[model samples]
Target: MRWSAAALAAGQILVGGPVAAAPTVVIIALLAVVGLGVAVADRRLNTAVAWRQVSAVLMAVDLLATLGLVLAGLLQGNDELWVLLVLVVLAAALRYRIRGALAVALGAGLANGLLELLVNGGEPGPVIVGRLLVLLVVGGFAGSIARELDVERRLYQRMAEASQDIVAKRDEDAILGALARHVKDALDGSRATVHRYTLAGWEEVQLPDVLSVGSADGGPPLLTDEEGGVSATLHRLTWQQGSGRQPNRLTLPIRLPERPAEYVVAVEVTGPRPSALAEGALLALAESSAVSLATRDLIRHQEASNRRLERLEALRTRFVATVAHDLRSPLTTVKGVARILRGRREQVAPEQVDAMLASVERQANRLNRLADDLLDAARLDSDALELKLTDVAIDDILRSVVDDAGDEVELLGTPGLVVEADGPRLERVVWNLVTNALKYGRPPVHLCAETDGDQLTISVRDHGRGLGPEQVENLFQDFAGSGDPDSVGLGLAIVWELVEAHGGRVEYRPADPGADFVISIPRERTPGGSDR
Candidate 1:
């Protein structure tokens, strides 16, 4: 406004050059100085009261300056400075509505009228009255336009605020409740609800009242009735009572078509029905809420999947490192012994040759066992493993495995116990348990077997430090238990699978000084013998 006013003042001076009115130049300069000062002050303070007062004072100064120019006979017809009066009225209209515009119009018109009257010795005339009327008409029209624009601005602001609130909540419950309340407040409804259909039934969330009644017993069936078309889904329903009571209900679908689950936002209005504009705003809010919920669920699922992948990747890395180390140690030993025999065969004694050959054989066996474990894991993945089933003596397999392990293993319980299983798989399971005990446990590993009810119980107890905190349930997960580089951690996993295939279960019994692993297989009946 200041810049435009300055341009008008410059134009007035250019047109009045021959007339060289010093008084007109002085008035225009004063107007510019006051306007600029007030504008700068308002920017610095930025207070409502200060700007209002400044606006009023600025309008007054423009009015007085225009009147002085007219009285001096310098601002002639179509002088361009006349346009400054209209600008002042328009600026006031936007800020202060009709009343502000009227004030500007009256101040300018009355100043002109009084100056004319003073020149005419206080006589009323049609020219003064006609100009005043024109000013009033212009003020009224501009004010009306500003009022309409203010309404649209407010409506959009309200919607924007509600959207910001929805985004700020992290959890599902807060989002639903906030969306419901915003809709109710926007449409001037008495109560609002957000209903969702789950496996159990419909759940309703509302302000001041939250309920989760089943679909069968819930009072209103509007949500469960399954509205078909778009209009049926997002339309209004009216309920009337005998006592001249009526209420308006609005429903909008939260999700789009072909959704796995159904959701609706319902509102109840006790007063006049909402206008079409209000309904549109409410529907937009519901659609936004639906998209938000879908996005939140997607992010959560992705995070869970990423965590699982990270865990598997860590396990895979550990498995590779362990296998490489286990294989390399035996290979290194075998390579050293073979080099000794090949290079120094003539000088080495006969007895030393035998000892070196035995060492090579033991290391080769270790490498072979490692290879077998990897092969078993690959077969397990492809489901190509089959068991050779037969009736086996459990006590015989356990005793034989303990003896072959070459450790101070104590065998407890009677012999001659039999069960239905693959002999080689059962023996392998016992060998795995015994190897684990010898590697990780202290001395005095105990192997026990007994008949219990309809099953035979075989247990291996190791008198060593029990399992670590991370080694409990994950002991059977592939490459999961011990942190030892020599142990590939696949023995226990294979043992678990073979036992489960034989209709048996493997369990860990916690003990004070060590850990006990128990395997129970259903007792087998012989041709001429009763159930064991």
Candidate 2:
């Protein structure tokens, strides 16, 4: 019945006589008040003592109230009625498990029976006796059912909690250990082992042994021929009997899904056969545990792969640095010889001199540029490029870069754009951009700069075919140039690296007739701590 004040008042009026009803009413009212108070105080009852003690006190008070009703001759002394009291006592006993509930049941039964006999002047009628017997039977049956249900509920709760714990764990060993213990506990076995099959052979994992169960000494030999590779099977095995030894035999081989019979589970048990439900539950848990284990293993492998890739990249950067260093001296010597030959061109045969000097200078300059590019790439890859910070007019840097290009490309931009950054690196960035525009793009490449608030943006727009989405996505990556093989792919990568070193970023877009590269740098206050 739904519990409320009205229900309690009605129940008291029906069971208790008019003379005794007032006290009962007052007690019920007090209990209702106390219950509400307890509910309010529950938030503070975080400690175990409060939970256990408060509940015990409440149950005791309820039992005592029932006893008082019997004493006052207010309650009917029918068997069915008494049986209901016993059931209540049982429920209270189960929840609180206090010694008082037992006393209440026994004492109330004897006292109420005696009171009924005294008031009625003798033994009650057959109807009353039958009601008493029915009460006893019903109470006992209800109590038994409640106990069994509680056990089942607890078991299900434990399984759910265990599954949650397993899923939350990332460590492979801990997950396996917990899974093995869960299997062993559920199956009532001394041990449970998990064997994983590989390309070479079956590898036995001593999961149960790790959980401190059976001796890791010996077990049924797991071979490739075992049930044709770990299919679903159960086998009974008897240990070799020795002197002074009892026959230590047990049922083995509970196969999990996705694993071959080669993945054997040897459960040590004293019984002849495990229950059907237990066997099924054990197999299911094992299968799920295996999947979790496999997922964790894959994650571990991926982490290892990432570590190796990082190491390889570091080695490549070092190799590039070393090669650039080695080539610098030879390149310098070759350039020096070319310059000397060019100086002496007039003294030599006119035709051969011009051509020879020109060829020599061109090859030497190409070699020098290759060496510089390699060195720059290495520095960029290792993040070792240092910037010399300064406050410089953006127009000056643009003019310098354009002049260095020697009329190879046209430049267009506002004359007075200013920014606070590493002047040399910024110049290099602009030079690389303009050179790239001339080398890969059609003529009349345009340069522009703009400023807003605390940021300045410079753009180089080319008058050639625009880049596709794929090229734009990978434009800043090393060796990611498009078009002819004659073009070295490190120019834009260097530009991106230098700009980033200055705390700036580079972006690419389709210029109406070609491609546009834009660099945006934050305009910080000068080192004197004053905003520009």
Candidate 3:
């Protein structure tokens, strides 16, 4: 705008015969030189205030140049130079849309009319009015087109920046939040929110209903009930709660991998409807956001797999250390006790010989338990473990396991309780729980059995402090679940697998200042021989 307006007057003065109007031509030449210099030297103003000031100065330069050319044309009796008035109107229009253009048009018309009226006063009023009308139309039409072009350019630029922000995050929540904020700001909206759609809708899932779906037959399907768009809502654009005025809804359908239902983001506004450019910018942002969401899923999955691998490696290292120490220590004790009995049978007292034998028996039992755990774990891994379900007295199993744990244990059994379960496998489950409590916990272990509706539950609790939350999380994994030196690395894992085979689940309970483990199975669920 600045250079072109200036150059036109400068070019005409140089090429055309312009010596007739000396002062007016000099003014035109000076304005041309100044406008060209300013255009070349200027930088883009950063603030709104600076832009407005620069805009005013440039508009002033254009207006003066146009006026100078008009006056020069009049003084020289040349009709062609005044045609530059349209450039003045267009410059204003590009700077400040429609109204600015109209104002400049009025100024151009006045200059032409007044110049003609003074220079040739007998010129008809009708011709002057017609010239003014034509100038006004030119200003309006040109301004409108330029304004539309600037709007489109700004919209696309903002969308590109917004897309970058929305996808920069590597997590799901952050991506959703960025997309909502960009949409809200783009539409000049009051609020925006993410809406997720399932068979059950809205607040139950912690979002506002922006759109609702009912079966065309008025059934309950949400996503499939769509005419062309998904059923969901967010912000004030609620479909179910119609108030005094209807709010507009813009839904972005985001499909997360492996999720059962459709995910949606919605935008709402209490203001005027968004312009076409804003809507286009918004849709482009949504497309970018969907791709970012998929990327987030991939990134998170990769991170989880990495953590799992690290955990497995750590557990493997720990399991190796435990097996060496635990198996080797017991074997050494058994060998030493046997050597003592054989080497000094006569020298050792009868009581000393009996004590040595008892010591050997205890070490043998320790080695047997460790071997049993490894064997059970291997059977579980290969899915070769079987359950032989039969009617068994729950009280008897509880009593037997508690007795095996010695005098430090107590049984609080419901005497009449019975369950259809694999009697030996159920006993093994109880034995492992009792032994785990004793190894990792204090004395006075409590064993109890109770009927819970159609299920039977056995609970073993110890007086020692409970396990930490982190320990509880990996409590069923091979090698990772053991916290004690002699959890044997596979004791609890075997318990979990054996219980699961009986259609049961093992759970950890947080007793006050103690650790409690519970095993529960449906008493009526009798599947046998590994077939079911």
Candidate 4:
């Protein structure tokens, strides 16, 4: 506004010759200086509180200047001075659009027409009427264009704000919902719905339907129903904007950069077809939402990885403590017994010495059992456990584990039960189960085995505190124990893994007073074995 006004002022001064009207030149210069100073102040302060007031005051100045120009031109007989008035009207149209055009147009038109009649005391000529008409036409035309520019400016501002809002969000679903909400706000829509692309097709994600949940697959394939990829998707969006067919539902595809297309953010508009700008906003929102999703997905994966690391750390800590505690008891017994026998050999009786040696043997066996379990568990964890199957007598394996049926423990099974099996591993399984029964259960422990056709079934039963219905589902999973601090919980876990390796399975039965663990393996004999 200032620059144009200054140029016009310079031209008028030159046309009328320098010093034609010093007062008029000073007034135009003062207006430019004042306008430029106020505009710069407003920008620096970053405030528009007094903008309306300042605009009104400036319009008032414009009017006063126009009347002054009219009088100055008449007095100097310089008719080109009217151009300054035309510049003011044109400036108003570009600046204030609607109201600016109206005020400046009214002011300039009246100054040319009515002021001429009052000053010259007669009818205004064709020049005055023509200037008035021109000002009005320019004002009306530029005002409409200015209004459109303002609308576009405000729309772009809103899109930017919405983009900022979703960028700060952490969850992918929340990001989609926020974008959908803003897109719905831009249009006349009730509520926006976010859909996750799935193999089953577009599935609603918000307040998710768990029973019929959607997974990330080909998101809203309707976009890519045609041959092309992104082009077809965009073409579909354009069609929806103008396609009277699916006017009620508008879907926009959201995709990650340098990756496959992801999900869709959709809005259901109740009113007429959305304007092009509204659709453009939705498209912008889709892009912003896609970026938010990618960011959130990265953060989510990082969090999951951190949690897994933490769990692994805890597991290692627990495992080390358990191993130390479990082996210490047997080691202490073995060491104490050996020391007593060595130091008091002459004082001890023959039977007492034999008993002490047997006790030492039992403790040594317990230590060895723990060591085997630890090694087996490590092998199972690494997926390296293997079986050495042979034609072996099952009855011999079970009987060898416990020849003397003590008062509390009993072994019951068929005689000469033979099958293709790993004899030592089979013995280890029986020993672990029996030891577990003695340590954990209120025995009356029974280790039973039978053969039904070609399938051999072996069961260990005891009356004890057993698992409840809701206790644990993954009973065979490692570390799933009864929380007994003295016992390492890998007994049952190793039992299950070892059984599975033998083409067999282990099952637990919830009895009334205790629990029963049953193992079943193939009962086939080795083809080339002697029938001894």
Per-prediction tally of clashes: 0, 7, 5, 1
Minimum summed lDDT over a 10-residue window in model 3 is located at 207-216
Best by TM-score: 4
lDDT of 2 by residue, 1-532 (tens): 1143335445656765686577557656655755675686587788877777876676656555554444443344332334335644665556634444445455555555665677566776674455445445544555565565565565556667767777777876677677666755654666555555557865677554443576566545322222344322433221222123322223233234544433444444444454344444455555566566667878899999998788567656754664465466556656665676769756767776656655555445445555566676777667666665677898788776665455655666666776778776677677678868877788787878888577788998889887888778878876565654444357788888777766678998787798888998887844544211
Q: On residues 163-213, what C-alpha lDDT tens digit does candidate 4 reach at each position?
A: 999898987666766776777766656545555656775555643422112
TM-score of each: 0.59, 0.47, 0.66, 0.78
Give stretches of model 1 more than 4 Å off: 1-155, 188-194, 204-253, 256-273, 305-313, 332-366, 379-400, 422-424, 468-473, 482-489, 523-532
lDDT of 3 by residue, 1-532 (tens): 4455456556556645645346446656757665664565465556778766766776776677677666666666666556677777877787788888898889888878888877666574787678778779988998899887887788788889989997898766677777766666666655555656545664222322222211123222222222444446432122222236535555555543333324566555555655666665666677777778778778889999999899778777777887888778878978888787778778998987777776667667666666767777777778776666789988887776664567889988688888888786678778878877887888789998988888888889999988988989988777765556444357778788888777788999999878999889888874342422
RMSD of model 4 against the true structure: 6.1
lDDT of 4: 0.70
Clashing pairs in 4: 197-219
**Against the correct fold, how does model 4 do in TM-score?**
0.78
